[model samples]
Target: MNCPKCKSVQIIKYGHTHYGKPRFRCQDCGRQFVLNATRQPIDEPTRQLIDKLLLERLALAAIARVTGVSERWLQMYVFQKFYQTPKAIDVTPKKQVG
Candidate 1:
């Protein structure tokens, strides 16, 4: 397939996303783009589901199991707006909680 950046057909498969979508790199412009560029972004249904889980008393692993989203992903997307960066809290560690 041609690259979106350079419109060149010299693109090659670069990598795969965790979601299993193939990533491609443009040889001409050295730009990377997902092969399914036209695919729509994640929908609000998933976001709302995550928000509900965040409000409940469920743990990350418990939420992840029911929602089919990774524990790390659920935490970031749910708490993203509250924190400047998702790394502000470590999901796993021996640190004491304030």
Candidate 2:
């Protein structure tokens, strides 16, 4: 990372801030920087909305507009998580009971 003081690219990760922000230590001139990427995928409010939409079975595009999250990202979460697949009437198999 470039130094915030002198714009040098020599830097290393120190630790974290009080609020748990990533802290970087510059090796070029001994400068510390806190790398805070504000653009997070899902915030607390968005996460709550995600849960609500999942429960309500709402469409991804609509949810994306409301939460500012991409539909593809939402789909990844659904597929990766323990979500049950909706069964089709024609595709569902019949089990034989003996």
Candidate 3:
């Protein structure tokens, strides 16, 4: 089979991936990849839903339960999308006024 990255016919068997999928290395680009990459990316709709839930002030654990996504993944996704970490403001009580 040809290399998917460079479309080169000069491909060599680069052993198997962690899940035992056949991996190939392209001679042209020196890139190694599996035939069927088993990465399941979160879809746009799910991303939007996550953003909505976040805006609604939902707890991370609650959002994870509702969206079926891990809290760590949600945290990383939010950081990547907004280029910043979400933090809550700290409010302190003051003395009562006369």
Best candidate, lDDT: 3
C-alpha lDDT (0 to 100) for residue 2 of candidate 3? 73
Clashing pairs in 3: none
State every prediction's TM-score relative to the real structure: 0.41, 0.42, 0.44
Q: Spell out the clash pairs found in candidate 2.
A: none
- The positional error of residue 66 in candidate 2, measured at the CA in angstroms, is 1.4
Among all windows of 10 consecutive residues in model 3, the one with the lowest summed lDDT is: 89-98
lDDT of 3 by residue, 1-98 (tens): 77656679999999998788888899999989777532445667887999999788787789989998877787667655665433643333233344
Residues 1-98, candidate 1, lDDT per residue (tens digit)? 68766689999889888779988899999999886532333346766776787568567788778877766666555555456555656543332244
Ranking by TM-score: 3, 2, 1
Question: Would you give me the overall lDDT of model 1?
Answer: 0.69
lDDT of 2 by residue, 8-77 (tens): 8888888899778889888888988776553443656777878798677676777777778877777666
Model 1 alpha-carbon drift over 4 Å, by segment: 1-42, 85-98
**Please, what's the RMSD in Å of model 3?**
11.1
Superposed by TM-score, candidate 2 places the C-alpha of residue 58 at a distance from the truth, in angstroms, of: 0.8
Question: Which segments of candidate 3 are over 4 A away from where they belong?
Answer: 1-39, 84-98
